[model samples]
Target chain A: MAKSFRDSLEAGFTITAEIPPPKSVSFPKSIEVAKKVAGKVAGLNVTDNQRGMMRMSSMAFSHILLGVGCDPVWQICCRDRNRLALQSDLLGASALGIKNVCVMTGDYPTLGDNPGAKAVYDLDAVQLMKLTDGFSNGKDIRGGVMKNHPDFFVGGVVNPFYEPIELELLKLQKKVNAGAKFFQTQPFFDIESVDTFLEQAKPSGAKMLIGVTPIKSMKMLKFLNENVLTKPIPDGVSKRIEFASDQMMEGLKISAEFINGIRDRVDGAHIMPINQVASLPLLLDMVEEGNGA
Target chain B: MVYNAPAMIITKKKDFEEILFAIGDTRSLFLLGCGDCATLCKTGGEPELKEMSQKLVAKGIAVTGTAVVPAACHELDTKRVLRKHKDEVDKAQAVLALICGAGVQSVGDNTDKPAYSGCDSLFIGNSKRQLHYYEKCSACGECVLNDTAGLCPETRCPKSLLNGPCGGAVGGKCEVNSENLCVWIDIYNRLKKAGKLENLLLKISAPKDNSGLAKPQKLELKREPGR
Candidate 1:
């Protein structure tokens, strides 16, 4: 059996990386990258039509990862599916032996390539997480008895960089109440904000993996800072990246620095490579070196 | 005046075929209209009610009576109006309310006769112009206008996202509507204009407190004896 992400967290500090599925049908390139990182990290998170752009299904990609003897964190976003569809997908994931699941209120459909597509957010993240919890306990969301239950180690997303950290903390508490076993936050740049979030959220007793996105270029850093609504890249960091002769090297250094800063404070680090999927091995090496392990 | 109580907006007029089918075999009808909302919407004003009465009479049905109340949603006012027209109301088999859903309920509460809605209650909004009105508030119960720079995502955004400008927004317009500005983007720009982008950065609104909006909401204040 594949080791559970929750168990990995309990054993010690864990590392998880996200691999957004390709937009095309062919998965040779993505599968190759997953195979390389599968042994380096505890698990990999397969994004579901991330940014509303149509990609191969996260569950299908996860099944592929499982075929290759890898543990996959199958992310289920609430944006695309209604309750019935979501419940059905959960059962399908469980039947395929996909153990780890992450629940997110997905990016709006307008953000994707198909801007005209209708969104089906019949359940928000909190409600969806609650439903998954029901499935694990042998009952459907309506309290109907189930002949077989799909046990999942459910996770949720949080934004430590979000302003008004108190509200985020309250949401974290609510997610915990709704059955989120672990949390993966938006990428963090300011260490003080992470410290403050940790101080307030410590009482919730939920393990959290701080997000660390490696800046691939100056434009990428600028886009994340300006366009991304949830996480903000600080001006000081952006200025540093702008001045660097080699932005990729600067970004890797910053990613490693962020991981090192929060390694002791957080339960784990979630690395999002964005478009630079090939850099996963190098990023992992830098993280290990930063941890001095 | 301290509270900005919601004002109803005019709704779509029910199709005549549907109404005839619903009233089924009833010859006489009592028609009710709202002078406020239905009048503004051109659905249930005195003119529309008179037109409907003429249409019903033309279709071989008796128009027992018709009254345009200032606000059909006001139960006590509707009750008094119905009492004044008790003879006509008693003669009718069913009362047709040409106002919003609340008005239909109000008319039903005021009379023993079966009340049928004549127009759909669209939303709470203000008159954009003489005959134009846009939906404004969804009454989500927990208001976040302070954090959103007065533009409401709950009512404006198709998704009602708390944290947003979800990736679909293109050219400052909503992905769903395309014609309307994405409320999240509007909120961000508005905050930036006010030089208080810190509000957007600092506050993370939780999943809306849906409990505060339990249906049929009631509020009571302790009395300070007789004035």
Candidate 2:
């Protein structure tokens, strides 16, 4: 059985980090970074086709993480493979010793360099979780066949600050019914929206971890404000990131403080650095000081 | 030393997928690419094989391995290739062949793994890249092209009469109601262009021995050096 959120969080703070697959055949530096983050985070989430560049397969990277004594959450997408292939791969993943899988409907391949390749979407996110329900019961995907199954802790993602909170909650309920044990949502910008999603998700037993992608530059802040989900940069927060102070160091410190403002309401935080995996220690320190208050 | 009515058809990628799905996970997959026919068609080429491999890999399916030899139908070549990848092929629960019927049988004879055709075969022996196929030949394949102005009146002319302006030629097209121009009309137009229209009316139907007309005459040739 998968551990409950309260039981899983033995320590007061549960920090999970993101690890991107390496760009080359060999991954010494990537593995080293994974080992470093494992010491500070509860588990490392290995991305699959992140931003659509072909990288080392996520399963192989997951195995590497597990070898180095780090918990690896395999990110599974419904972008490329069809139902038969997805079903087969899920079984193969369980055989290869991966326990945690996060299901998401990945980005369209045209978003990446490969524009000509076709995307085989055999199943969407909710259907995939339904397909995986067999594993939770120790039965194969066929439901009649019995096979060695993975002790999976399945999770889904949602964006609270995303507009139309009712629709998002409906989908969230569907994911929970489809057997998602936890939710890793888009970042919490407005405390009210975070409070709103939490109150809605209070009934579902799935643990909710707030996804935080830190905004560093004005350009990045703009990108997050515009591109990242539908999260509105409330007026006071925009003024803070724009003119918190003339000094960038002062502005970043203020931004860090802003993230700290809503740390209490979440079970944990999933920090996406984009490409700043090395700066995780600083971000974690900021969160620690924020929580220490 | 000639071909008549040779027919060949090609299958698509969906066909390959359907065949693979028929042989599910219970079977191991061994893909053998032919060095000759499949290689020429580029269907079972190394690049396509690697692509298939990657497709299977991304799905986390275990395939025995892929191997192409001089000729999948050649017993010696297939034997050597199978032996080289034997361990991986043995791991494959099933064997798939991207070769013709003969090649499939050749590999099947040597190993116990069931061999399946990767490409569909549709030829009754007369396979040619001719501009157009001839349903029958009188083999009086004599110098007819020269007199007929390069349009064979014997075979292509549906009327089979060695005469011009057969009243079936309309608007320089066929009145046999064909999408094609009547061969006699084309002969007339071309001959007229070359000032040789007189040669077509040469009154030449020398007791056309067409007992063999629109029929098949079976004969054997040395298709391969030994066979």
Candidate 3:
């Protein structure tokens, strides 16, 4: 039997990488990329209509990853479904033998190409986690018994850089209480904040994977710093990336250094290359070398 | 600060024609005003009540009496105020309540006379100046203010999104209403100011718990036997 991501985390440092579904119907490129990193990483997380843009459903793409001999972490966002639809999808995903799942409150629909689309946020991340937990326990959201329950290793996301760290910690506790077995955080630029957050959150007992997004270009770094991420990129890192002749190499080095710095503190790292899937293998190799894996 | 409770803020006064049409053949009327919400909203205050009385009299309708209660929604206070004006209330054909929906219902429950609302209740909000109010809560039953740096997306966002600066927001303004700040952006900025920006990124809030918001909500507190 293949080891679950949770088991990998418990055994030692785990590595998971995200593969965003393509906007088009074709999956050959995405599947090829998954096949490349299949054995190098513990699990591949397929993003769901990330940023509200329509793409191949995460569930379908995750199945494709499964066909390529990769364990897929299927992401389900609350932005597009009500309770009924969510429950149906959960059962369907499980029936297909997909075991790992990550629940999130997707980006608002207005942020997507279909700005006029109505968002169906019938449940938030916490509630969805609880609902998923219920499914694992052989019960539906309404407490009805199920003949076949999904055995999912459910995970959630956290941001260590969010302001009012105390409130964020409280929310993290709520997610834990709601049954989030693992957590993947937003990208970390400053190590100090991650340490502070870890010190406080360690007692919750949920496995955590710190997020690392390798910068592709100076413009990408600037855009992420100014608009995408709430945490401002540390000036030192930005200055390094800005001055580097090969920005991608600088970003990779920075990410590997960061992963090395916090490898002991966290269970793993979730590397998100966004649309730049080609760089994932190289980044993983750097991380493995730094970790002596 | 000991007892901070929700208050209703009215925005529009029913048109005179609408009110007269609602009164419908009721020649005599009794007026009730809310000293708290309606007074602040300028809809059912003492001055407005007196003005309404005059308007009714001009239309050849008899205004039997007028009384402004401390809070028209406070059933006990309204009951006491109505008892004091029992004779006038009993004489009128119908009662015109220039308060909110709750106040109108309170009057109806306490009086035998038909009760009609004269103002439309808009939202649970506050204002710094007269005739200008801002909606702050939708009473979603599930509050996520702690996660959003005390900004409410359920009411502030045109889409009532829990996770957002929906794509429609431009220049920090809402896509639906350019004059208003995009609540998610405001939340992001506030979280940034408080050094809690990571809260927005980390926490994926679930859908609002609307089950607790079923209408005619009632709450009863437990009390000690000898309290």
* Residue A49, model 2: Cα distance from true site in angstroms: 0.9
Interface C-alpha RMSD per candidate, 1 decimal: 7.2, 34.1, 7.0
What digit string (tens of lDDT, one per residue) describes model 3 on residues A1-293? Answer: 35667679879888899998887887687777777888888999999998888988899888878888889999999888888899899999998879999988777777788888888767777788888998899888778997768989988887676544454565677678778888988888767977877888897788989888888788898798777776678888999998899988888888888888888777888998865888888887888787422
Q: In model 1, what are the clashing residue pairs, if there are any?
A: A52-A112, A110-B168, A111-B167, A111-B168, A163-B201, A163-B202, A163-B203, A164-B202
Candidate 2 DockQ vs. native: 0.01
TM-score of the second chain in candidate 1: 0.92
CAPRI-style class, candidate 2: incorrect
Q: Candidate 3 chain A — worst ten consecutive residues by lDDT sum?
A: A161-170
For this target, which candidate reaches the highest DockQ against the unseen true structure? 3
Candidate closer to the true structure by TM-score (higher is better), 1 or 2: 1
Model 1 scores a TM of 0.64
Candidate 3 segments whose C-alpha is farther than 4 A from its true place:
A291-293, B1-128, B137-227
Give the distance in Å from residue B63's predicted Cα in candidate 2 to where it truly belongs.
52
Q: Please write out the lDDT profile of model 1 over residues B1-227, one tens digit for every residue.
A: 11123345659998988888989998999999887777877898888999999999999999899998878778888998899989999999999989999889999987889998888777877664667677768777778888888988778988776655434454566656778977766676677789876456334345454556668898888889895
Best by lDDT: 3
Better of 1 and 3 by DockQ: 3
lDDT score for residue A116 of model 3: 83
lDDT of 1 by residue, A1-293 (tens): 45657678888778899998887888687788777777778889999998888989999989988887678999999888877899999999999999889998887777679888888776777777878988998888768988779998988888665444444555677678778889887778878877877788898798888888889788897788666645567887888799999899788888887888777777998998888888888887787786423
Q: Count the backbone clashes (under 3 Å) in each candidate.
A: 8, 4, 20
- Best-first order by DockQ: 3, 1, 2
Clashes of 1: 8
